[model samples]
Target: MKQKTIGLLGGCSNVATAEYYRFLNEAVNTRLGGWEIAETLIAGMNFGNIEAFVRTGDWDGLGRYMKTKIDGLVAGGADVILCVSNTLHKPLEDLMDRGGVPMIHIADPTGVAMSAAGLSKVAIFGTKPVMEMSYLKDQFQHRFEVQAIAPTEEEQCDIDQIIFDELVKNKLKDTSKARYLEIADRMRREEDAEGLILGCTEIFLLIDQDDRPDFPMFNTARLHCEAAVDFALS
Candidate 1:
């Protein structure tokens, strides 16, 4: 069988895109040994245009724009596609149907992990849309029979600001990390959340399983990359 080329649609923020690239190569080498790496093609867009479409509620325009990007990847011999950002999945839904390549959703693997752990409810922290909208939350409920809990509206704004102002710029602050943990702890204590879904790709930079060893964290980026490698090798 010919090795499939993985297509990455990224640049929702370049910070998370780099993580996806690193994870794919590291995983391939670890599994196959030697210096081997997965065959990959990246179609990165300008974050400015992406955010503009999103902020204006122009999902149709965003979908058209993303379709063009993904079309280029397909032309470049990309066999399967993965959008690095959870938020981008909203615009890429139509592209997934028309692109003719297997597109791995960022939520599926996380949902599987939550289900396997027998978690009925989990706390999610991400960009505004991922938390406020039904995209990721609905996927978990419908596909895995799991419920997702989001921060309160005020808390959502705080989290969204942290993601755009700090994490996307590749700036990490101890203060922001402290705040995120504080929020997570409150959710766990009050909401009866069974686990945490690090819904945004860049969140792994802020905190991970080690930050709260007593709590479960589902790292969507890691799980998504693992799924990509499995599909590539299979």
Candidate 2:
């Protein structure tokens, strides 16, 4: 069987994309039981452009720019493309409609995992844009038949700050991680969430199951990379 080449649009934080690269290659090697790694192509994007689009509400312009960039990856032999950012998944359809390459959505795998685990509800952590955007949450809810919930207004602000201020810069503070854990607990208690989603690719840097052993945590970057590698090897 021929392996599909994985193409990635990364650097939404630079940190997240790097994690995706690591996780995808690691997963491929583990599954193949050798030094095997994915044949990957990456088209990096500046975080500034993404922020500008969100700030200025110029999604159309952002879509055009991403579509053009992804075209480069497709031309370079990318069989499948991954946007690689939870926030950027908002403009996902625009790029996918180009029909140049098959695009892997970030939330789809999470939804699938949730459904398989019989989790009825999950709380997501990410930037303001990711939390505010209902499309991603809807995909999880409608497609997987699970309730996808976001943080409270205060929690959203803090999580957004943690992603932009510390996580993106590769900084890790136990205090901030603890705060995130607290919020997840609140979601479980108040909303009856069965699991937690580290939706922002950068969030996995600070929090994981190690910190909260009792809680079921879904690391989006890791899960997305696993899905990418599965597609490549399929």
Candidate 3:
């Protein structure tokens, strides 16, 4: 069989895109036990335009824009597609509906990971849309008995600022790091969350195991990459 080329739809920001690429490559190389990396096709879109479409919730415009990218991936011989951004998945569903490509659902892999972890309740941290919407929650609840929890109103604002102003912009501030740990502590104490889900790919930029030693932190980026590795190798 030919080596599968995974198509990555990135550009929520360069950092998260970099993380996805690094994670996928690392996982493939480690598993294969050689210098060979996963074959990938990436089309990094304009972040400004992506932000505009997301802010307006313009599914039609988003779908059209993504279709052009998907077409390019097909032309580049990508066998499967994966969107690196959680927020972009809003538009991705529509694009996949029209693009006729087998696109991987990034959240589904994370859902499976959560199931494997045996977590009954997990704290989900991400953008407002992801936190408010049923898409991610439904995926987790249906696959596992996982109940997703979010930060408090104040904590949400802080997280939003950290992600947008700091993490996305590639400035990981110490204050933002502290805030995330504080939020994680509260999630465990108040919400009784069994673990934390870094639902946003950019989140790994600011927080990690050092911040939340008390609970297992599931990095969605790593989980998504592992799933891609399995799919590609399978």
Candidate 4:
């Protein structure tokens, strides 16, 4: 199969951005064997700038900023695009509306996985905006018929704090991890959430499927990368 160049619009947090690159290359090599690598283009943005755009609720400005990044990737021969941040998909979709190379929506793969797993309800963990926003929840509902749940407002603040104050900065603490798991447990017990979506790209840094073997967990970053690799090799 001929591989298409995968364009990554990243650095919403350089940590997750780097993981996307590594996951893409490793997946390609595993499939093809013997030093094979994905044809790729990375347009890394300054997180501070992206954060500012998000915080100010400047959707138009964010869309325009991301469009410029996507333009560079297309100019560099990228056949497809993937923005590495879940929260940024709103702007990414705005860019899509204006037309460009084919792009993957990060939530789609996770939604598909949820449907395949027969999960009717799932909890989401992400930045404050991501949890409060409908971008992912609505997508899951409309596309997969899955019910998406976000933690309570207090839980949302705690998760958001950990993401920005620790995970994005590459600081992982056992206390934070424990608190996250406690929240996950509460979601499961109270909301009857059958699974959990690691909605933030950096969330996997704190906890994963291994933390609770029986609970269904969707790591959006890894799922997104796998989907991109599948498309690249298709």
Collision count for each candidate, in order: 0, 0, 0, 0
Candidate 1 backbone collisions, by pair: none
* lDDT of candidate 3 over 51-80, digit per residue (tens): 788668786798788778888988898888
For model 1, the stretches where C-alpha displacement exceeds 4 angstroms are none
Alpha-carbon RMSD to native, per candidate:
1.1, 1.4, 1.6, 1.0
- Give the distance in Å from residue 36's predicted Cα in candidate 3 to where it truly belongs: 0.4
Can you write out model 4's per-residue Cα lDDT over 144-225, one digit (the tens) per residue?
Answer: 9998999999999999899888998899999999999999999999989999999999999789999999999999999999
Let me know the TM-score candidate 1 reaches against the reference structure. 0.97
Winner on TM-score between 2 and 3 is 2
lDDT of 2 at 224: 85
Candidate 4 local accuracy as lDDT? 0.92
2 versus 3: better lDDT goes to: 2
What would you estimate as the lDDT of candidate 1?
A: 0.91
Displacement of residue 48 (Cα, Å) in model 1 is 1.0
Query: Which consecutive 10 residues in model 1 have the weakest lDDT in total?
Result: 91-100
Among all windows of 10 consecutive residues in model 4, the one with the lowest summed lDDT is 91-100
Whole-model lDDT values for every prediction: 0.91, 0.86, 0.83, 0.92
lDDT of 1 by residue, 151-211 (tens): 9988888898999889989999999999899889999999998889999999989999999
Off by over 4 Å in 3: none
Best-fitting candidate, scored by lDDT? 4
Better of 1 and 4 by lDDT: 4
